[model samples]
Target: MDVKRWLEGVQPRPATATFIAEALSRKAGVKFSLEDVGMGGVITPATLELGLEYTAAAPKVGSQLLGLTRRDLAEDPLAVEATVVPSAWTQPLLTWLLSRPEPLPAGNGIQVNVGDSDIRAVRMTTQLFMKLDFQFGGGHARAALAQYYVRDVSPLLEGKFTEAVGRELFSAAAEVAQLLGWTAYDLGRHGLAQRYMIQALRLAQAAGDRMLGGRLLGNMSHQANYLGSFQQSIQLARAAQEGSKGIASSTTMASFLAMEARAHAGNGDDRACSYAFREAEKIFDSRNIGDDPEWISYFDEAELAGEGAHCFRDLRKPLIAQEFAGHCLELTDPFYARTLSFIRLVQAATYVHQSEPCQAVALATEAIEIAGSLKSKRYLRYVSDLCTDLAEYRETHDVGRFLEMVATKYPAL
Candidate 1:
């Protein structure tokens, strides 16, 4: 349909808006209802293209995505579908980005003296968004952070600051970028999330924050695994392990090892997965209070246990997976509604593997209810997976009802 070009030339009619929304749905990997498109509002193609372009982000911006602004991005008027195929900003873009020299200002421009307070404010905002992301889901937080990043943080990078201050600002900005990537991933925007994470890694590197950079790599690995690129996931995890060898705390190391374990489990390498799990536990037990980086402080025993359950589930060890998943559910806080929902889904998957269809359906129902309250496509993805697992048992009355219930609750699924 060449939506970008079409919108440039014609005002969007109701039928055209509906058509565009449907087109976005087809691209997003999920269905979208006609009501999703805003009628009577002018469709902004440039903004839409920008959002779509982010799905496959370039390593280095020739210029900060020409003609974007806080207001234009803040509302995300393009209503771009989430499922578009990533463009040039995928693997090749990452390769070129890594091979390129570090970013340096081209020439002296307007010097807006940046200070510690400015950097601190950015970090604080990042922390707040991180908490929000945990509670609600990436679907809600990603755009908010992106808007702020473009409006507030991006300029600081190009502004005049001392080398030390610049590094600090970059570090803070990198954290924001990392969260944006993570939230994007949570919303099922894998390619876009990858680009954001890679950019975050570069910013972290410029800040000399090896530990943060390593975490970013681990995050990338996590996404790669989700995308079914297990070998690439393993390589990225190993990079995280090596990159943060001395600088990272026990909790961070545990996270890296757990990520590697997941990739191994995905590959059916139970033995290798077990090895990584053991090392993760050993390092995790060795941690002292407050030793972990703020970024990885969430990788506590509960988080590790959840990962353990995930690994064992992938290995088809239903009993062991259930045990670990149960522990995670118990230890996780209620305020982390989205995390709790995911853990519940893991528990449900374990039940399905055990042939406890009734229990699985019940747990899945609970997860869906949780998902219903949040805007998280990732949580819904879990629900969709649960439906897939239950497909074999469709003849059972309970399973059939469960599937029907899910379809009713999430038509987009």
Candidate 2:
């Protein structure tokens, strides 16, 4: 947490034993015992080579999260790996370090040589902390943090950490990928989000977050539903519930179950949807609010109603769907804003299903504003569905105008 140590010109390297192993330590179970590893230790351009080896050799490897434990074929035995993800300025920093190398007696501490290898390592390590923030917090803040660090602090690192330091940095890069996936998910960018989420899942697997891995499955399930892969979504959700049964938050568990209900609704199984909804509701009712992690924290009485509305709408039960949709509020948090729009879009779909385009257009118009703010294509897809529903009500002038407006905005329409 002492980010200051990274801010250079300050010497007298900290004691070795106290060092945190960023990504590797998370896997190592205990903090790394950084006994001063002296000469002849060749560093790589990618710290992952070392981290992966460390992961593969650990005693409880396969029993752990990541299926990948060993280093890949691309790794070099003698070459020290660093990060490419860091900014260009960091390269000069290593040049400076490598140019002024001195033995400088590291009696009781680990000595970090100034070199490309070390600077790259520090960049990777910093990203790891950024990832930790994302796992605990939400995406907007995490993305903001990642952008800030990658652009700002990254320049100063200049890759001058020891192999131990490089390993630490690589861990951070994996963690960032994990968080980026979550951030993308919360933003409604289904396709791009999926890429980030899968990579994040992989990284967490490597980082040994069994709980995070399960959560990743839960996220994948949500994306599956958005893409109409409902069956796949349900299976993934169930997998998450089973995988992290003992460790995940009750809210997270319940949210996965709720997503499964949506999958059931997508498949037109009202019975299954109802069943899952009941279970999710029971869990939500029992828990105290604000205890849930922010990832699923958006699911509350109002949001659950909106979700139910979607299920009922999908199942063609307009009356029931409208009942739930009526209860959902107008939320505005940047992350939840798009979701709120989706809920309204679903509600609009329900109205359209019932042949009520006036209400559908009205709700959709509001939802469109929220969607327009997002860089997501899913919103446009939902709107396209809305326009399809609106064709049924083209007689009215206002409806015609709104339809025209949507048409103008999306030439694809």
Name model 2 segments beyond 4 Å from true. 1-175, 182-192, 206-208, 289-291, 330-335, 370-372
Off by over 4 Å in 1: 1-111
TM-score of candidate 1 versus the correct structure, residues matched by position: 0.79
Model 1 vs truth, CA RMSD: 8.8
Tens-place lDDT per residue, model 1, 1-413, is 65675556544654566777778888997876433543324334433344323222222331222122232343343332323332322442244224333553322337566789999899889988988888888877566777787768777766777766766876787798788778878877665565566567666776667778778878877887877778888888888887667778888888999999999999889999999999999999998757765666677778999999989999999898888888888888777788778888988998999888889999888876765568777788788888999899999999999999888878998
- Highest TM-score against the true fold, candidate: 1
Cα distance off (Å), candidate 1, residue 7:
17
Q: What does the lDDT read for residue 127 in candidate 1?
A: 87
Cα error, candidate 1, residue 273 (Å): 0.8
lDDT of each: 0.72, 0.54
Summed backbone clashes in each candidate are 2, 21
